[model samples]
Target: MFKTAKKLFTSLKFNYFSLFIISLVAIGLFSFMYDSVKQETYELHEFKISPKTIRSLKTIEDTVKTEQEKRRIENEVTPFYQFDEEVSKTRQAIAASLFDFIIEEKKANIPDPENPDKLVKSRSEQIEEVRNKFKKLEKEEPGLRLTDEAIASLLTAEVSDLTKMKQEIVSIIGEELSKPVRSEDLSAVRYEVERKLRSSEAVPPAELQTMITLGRSLVVETETINKELTDKRIEEEKNAVEPTRILQGQVIVREGQFIDSEIYRQLELTGLLTNQSSYKPMIGLILYVLFVSAIIYLHFATWRTDNYQKKKSLLIAIAVFFILVIIMKLLSLIDKEFDVQVAFLFPTALAPLLVKLLLNERLAYMMTIVTAATAGIMLLEGFSAIMQMEIALYILFGGVISIYLLGNNGRRSNILRTSLVVSVSNILFVAFYLQMTQSTYDLSELSFYLIAAFASGILSGALTIGLMPFFESFFGILSDMRLIELSNPNHPLLKKVLTETPGTYHHSVMVANLADAACESVGANGLLARVGSYYHDIGKTVRPNFFIENQHGNLNPHDELPPEKSRDIIIAHATDGAELLTKHKMPREIIDIARQHHGTSFLKFFFVKAKELGQDVIEDDFRYPGPKPQTKEIAIISIADSVEAAVRTIKEPTPDKIAKLVNSIITSKLNDGQFDECELSMKELRKVERVICETLNGFYHSRIEYPE
Candidate 1:
């Protein structure tokens, strides 16, 4: 069953399809989780009693109320009226024409018929003549029409009073005509003219009364309703009216309260009514999940490594991602349901910390970004866009902090310490966000956010401590912490090597130091190399006297055996060590290093000895069975293992001789194609050569002569 599952997961298709399935699950998770349509359905009838309160799951504009407000403001705006300057001038001209006719009649004084020099007409006779002439003139000019009473009063008034009255009447007519006098306001404008005439005192009371009547007639409605300007002004006011928004989580109706038209409309608008589900949000969520999945796939593609290609490693990352996302979703749901900001309490750093511990740092950074984005999306229903962005950035910063703090230190104490520092970072981030986004900080809000921030970090540490063992066990992951524990001297495997083969144990320790330093020089897993080197010779414990490392000064067991037998014994140790590590449930990487360190290099000494004995010998018979070193660390340990064993044979070691020996062994490994399967570059190989030589010189340097 395990083999079949492994074969199925190893396929490239499985990787792509796994990502597709994850995207689908994510879309479904966001679609149905806390959606308003999934809530209890409410009745749509108006004026009915509500059984329960309903809140909006998403923000939406209340279009009905917005339109009603627009209409109301449109109605409240007064219509625009335009004044007619031409009408004012024409009315004033008519009043002027009447006064001009009276003046012209006065100017046309006729000579007396009885006496040439003296006027023969009586004052009454002259007045009657003037009135008759004015009547004739009034027929010629239609605008000169006035009451006979006003005409007679004007003629009887003093000339100065007449001039003043004419000037006042013309001035009042022009002023009133210039104003915006709509037909509805014409009566008011006429009353205003009469008040002006009475106040003016331009003539006697009787003449003023007569002038008031004439002034009212002279005033005409000179203003008209401007439909274009009126409509434009109303439109401007309507645009200024802000649309009423139905915010998410706002109550639509209270329990046992009447559901009026507005409340019912709001419920329908928010999709709380039965059978009113909208698939728009679901579509958006699907697209979002696809986008995130594509980015994750590209990240993996760019840095494709054998570790990431393993199904278990990929599964561990996926598990961490889903765990963090689920926690975020649950917290967001609580925040929405209780109207609190509990979502801010989510352990945002959990994903990055776990991934960093189990995987590489680059993958940890990817986990940080993806989890932060998912948190932002999950809280979209509960927070504003700016607030969501701030939370996302905060989560991002926290994840980065966690990853950095746990750098190659996956021990429990280090994890907790890193988490404490992450908590401090979280607190600082929240404080900064509050200071930037808020005008007057609410003490309650600040306190809640701070508590959530601090707790989130501690919870991340706790949950990581709880879940790490499961991941390590289920996935057979070789974390740094596990490697450290396995490297302890008290471990059963290491103890077995020490008691049964003390010489081999000492040799293994020396090889470990050499491999660890060389591995680190080339940016490989040095701890894995060191720990793997310790157990690499565990197979020698099976027949302690057979191998020279465990032989000490004792007779070699291979002396009694044939050359082929000796070669087989030497070759069997690689397979034997692999079996022991497998039995002890050691990591695959350590087991591979032990099994492939010797590679297929021929045992030259045994083969030459067999040939010298006049026996038929094949080259293949003297070779160690190997799959070759398949990683940089395994290859480095292979070179280091041979270099350490060979360097011990030197009687008078110096830096120059150690350098020559290291280079020859590396070149021989290269010629034998032992490192062909790994990705160790020539530049890195040279670096490894230099590091090993330096380390050997330190170990085997000439000591100062001491007086005895």
Candidate 2:
């Protein structure tokens, strides 16, 4: 029944149709991921504010509030300050110049008492001349003069007191103007100078008042605001505000709560508010599925395997992919309905494990990529985009690690060990991801992730162990596990051969060794060839005395029988072994090896006997029935079987004799057209010959004769 099913699956037409159906199912499922049902719409008046506060359902940026808060923080920032050294120095210089002009004018206006002819100007005229000079200086340089009160006070001062006041006022003004002064603080600075001067008794009361007035006018504003610095400070503060995060399953709008503009926008961002424009998401999803399906098709089309095996592999890949997708979707639904983190416990490595065991490792890695991508899309609900991406990467890394640990061929114990490696990889990936995202390291949450990682590995191993036999039996696949099981010495057929015909059993073991080496040399399934060679002679168990290998003490049961009967007995083992293997439900490849190893070659020994006896016998009457070897492994086994039997006939085999015998046997088999059905190349055949010759020569090498 499985044979018929396998044949149907491997057929060209069925492969194409199945691929199409799988692609369609994938497209439908991916599209359903984003197909949102129309949400219930309510009018503004229908909304009522609830007494209890409501929270956001999804993590969405509140653009309106975020921008508003940023702007408010920016407005509250104080402007920057810039020191104006040039302005301060200019003000000090102008004050010093005004003092110098006053002192010089006081000296110049002194009456010339020594000379009666010299006309002396009146004090008022001199004061008027000094005031005109000050006015001219003010017109030359703006912001250089004192106030009206300060000028009036300086003009009425005594000459000696005025000169002393000029030095004191200029020194005080320079000291005050040296510091940064804002426009708003100018009056306060002036008052501070007046108070300082009033407390000083070094100058007369009139001079002190004049010094205070001049100091007030000299204290001009020098500091200005720096807009660039203020703006930079505001930007840094705005960036420091934590982005609002709405936990998964949080309530966006509670029952009977008013749907404000903010709530409405949240609903829209979360995909809860649907409109006619929603079909765009579905269209995008379909395109994505189509692209992935194309990749799958290209991988299968380019795979370097037989057409039948390619179809079988494709079917298995599609089945595994859909199984993973279904599991992911179910887990997502559970997470959504129960608000649990079951999705984290998903065994993403399960698909890769199955592929690695039942198929090739390359296919396993490829399927892992496809499964991870599909899972990321399917489990996007209730997860932030970043979380979904992390989950996908986590799945990819886990699958890769599992495949790497499984290696070329895995055993049951290897599966357990691989699980441990996968678990460690998963834990490391999760830890790295959390650390990179800067999430709070809650011990409970971390423990949960650790548990999930361990569970993923254990579950992957369990699922692979449980599903491997079914795939092997259903698909007629001879996986390495199955071959290993068959290669055990305690297998029923192998044990039967061991007990009933020890010599033939020994011969089969030798053939297995030879076939294994030869097949390995040519890059064939060496394990399968070894296992197949073990049971290739099981039919000899039925009549151990009829074959030469089981003939002990020179006893030959075929001597009493006719030549034709002896030939019948010899050839019957091939067909009889095939029947027994089939009855025991052995793999077809092993049965074919037992059936076709001889490949209808003429039994020349018996035929020569009949011809020497003057009896007319046809060549066809003494040939073994055969369908010929059908694969590289089977072909190698067939050649190795004949080579082992031929080498055993040499009583004292030498290296040159063994080489000649091996070469002659291979040449005869080639001329007999035994390997026409298989894909064994001429180059591979030469390598097989060399390896078999080397192994046999070493096995049957001359030993040192011991003195008895």
Candidate 3:
């Protein structure tokens, strides 16, 4: 059943379709993460009761509130006004000209002190002439206007009163003109001038009114609103107001609470209003999924990785990816619903552990990064960026630790030890992350996260243990764990060989040691070679007396039969062992080793015996079935098997003898084309010869001489 499934998955059409299906399912699952914040729409109104809570789907600037704040700041800014020195100078000059004209007219009315011949005019006539001249000046300078009564007073008053009026009017105009005088404050300026004139008592009562009227006329509007400066100030203040932001996951409206205008606007701003739908998130999610898919596809398609070339490997990779992604998605949902940090309880190391055990470590490391990235993206909406980073790093580091701790041994104890180490590492990672990111720690939350971390490790180990067998069976994989199980002495096949053919069992054990060491030197699957060696001689148990190893001192069964019968019995063992293994549902690799270890080598003893007896015989008939060793492990086992059997025939074994024998056997196998189907390079073959010689020398080493 498993073989059929493996064959089905291996089909090129099925591989493409399976990848498509996996990608589709992954995108579908991830769509929920992208659309997680699509809350139910509301028909809420201002000052009405809200039926349900509404949260922001994404972070966005609250433009309405921000604009309101900007406007308020702008209104509060004082309008800018600039002082006009030109206006002050002009006003003062006009007032001085008016006063100087009055003084000139007064001087002309009297005779000059130095010139007695100058014409002296009457006071009435002088006042008439000054009024006529001032009237003309007023027409020329609008700001210099004065009433007829003020002008008559200026001319008719005493010289002291005239002097006081001119000085007071010019001083008042200068003082008032120096400061900003807007059109709107012209009345205030006139009243101020009257008060100053009244308080000073500088001018006589008759001329005081004249001074007041003249002071008001001198103080024309000196300051105007500087429109550019006023606008610039408003803009500067408006820009200083920070923008209001509605953060993602912020609650816009709470259930059973009043929905005010602000809340209604927030709901609309965040797209929580009725009939609002945004496809941007969905589009972004599709792009992200495609990117991840493309990365995986590129690794498998372009890289020269050994396992990547196989379709079953692709299936296993996709399977592990789906498992981790789905598990993380479920954990994210649980964390959301429970409001607890259940994300820390995710089986972060499970994907890497399973992949490392079933396939290569490089692919395991790749899956670790992919899994962590997927988890981060899935939880980004629900968690803060710091927390998201923590989760991703936790998965990444935990996976690396698990891969290293798993080693190459897949024993139960080793897995348990790895889980315990992972648990401790997880606790330390959580504590460190929290300490670094959080300003203050909550004891309960920290303890919960730590506990979740420990539980995640334990859970990952438990799940890996439980699922390993299922995956191994489903994929027809011969994992290290399975090889260890098959290598046990108590196994039915090994026990059968031990009880039925003790000598063959002993010989098989020696061959197992030799093959295991040789394959390891050449970087092959040493455990597989050892386990295959254990069951290689199971067929010898069927006719235990016929084979020489199992014959012990019993009469040789081959001596009683014809050489043809003996040759048939010897060649039948290879096929018989293959049949037995196949019937027991053994792994294909072990069965292949059992079937092809001999590589059609000529049984020279049997063939030579037939030739000496003058019996008809063909060279092909003397050889075992010709399906030679097809892998490095099988090829090494074949050489080791022949070397070990040949070495046992040496009466006086030595390291030199064993070395020479190991080299000779490997060279003969090479010349006979037995290693042609296997990928054993010449360098690797040399290493194998040295390792086999060392192992055999150890086994056959002479013991220290002792007194009896």
Cα RMSD, each candidate:
5.6, 7.7, 4.8
> TM per model?
0.81, 0.67, 0.83
* Model 2, span 323-417: residue lDDT tens: 78778877877776643356667786898999878778888888898788777766665535423776788789999989888875667788878
Cα lDDT tens digits for candidate 3, 1-708: 977965665564634754775577556656655644234466767789988877776688999889989988887887777778787777667776776777888766776779965658765676677777678667867667666667666766667666666677778777877888887888898888878888877777766667777777676777887899999889888878888999877877789899887787787787777757666656766766777777777666655533324556777888888777778777767776764567788887898888988888888999999888777766553525223777888888888999999988888778878888899999999889777866675778777988999998888788888888988898778888899889889999999999999988998989899899998887788999999999887878778888878776668988888888999899888889999999999987888888999988889998899999998889889998959887899899898889988988998899998888888888899998998987999999999999988888788889988999
Candidate with more favorable, higher TM-score: 1 or 3: 3
Query: Where does candidate 2 stray beyond 4 Å?
Result: 1-17, 20-46, 50-257, 261-271, 274-277, 304-308, 337-341, 555-557, 560-565, 600-602, 607-625
Clashing pairs in 3: none
Worst 10 residues of 1 by lDDT: 32-41
Note the residue pairs that clash in candidate 1.
Answer: none
lDDT of 1 by residue, 1-708 (tens): 998966666665746755765666566556534352233455557888888867777688988889999989987999888877898888777677666655654455444667656554544555566567567545654544566666666655665667788788889888888877888887899999998888886757868777877787777768887999999999999989989999967777888889888787788887888768666655666666677777766666566566335446667777888777777767766776754467678886788888888988988998899888777767654425323777788889999999888877788898889889988999998888778966665678778889989998998899988998888888888888789889999999999999999988998898899999999998888999999999998998877888887776758888899888888888888999999899989888888988998888879999999999999979988888898898998898888889989998988999889999999999999999998999999999999999999999999988899999
Q: Which candidate do you rate higher for lDDT, 2 or 3?
A: 3
Determine which window of 10 residues in candidate 2 has minimal summed lDDT: 37-46
Q: Cα deviation of 155 in candidate 3 (Å)? A: 5.0
Off by over 4 Å in 1: 10-41, 51-55, 75-86, 96-214, 221-232, 249-252, 301-303, 325-340, 376-394, 430-452, 614-621
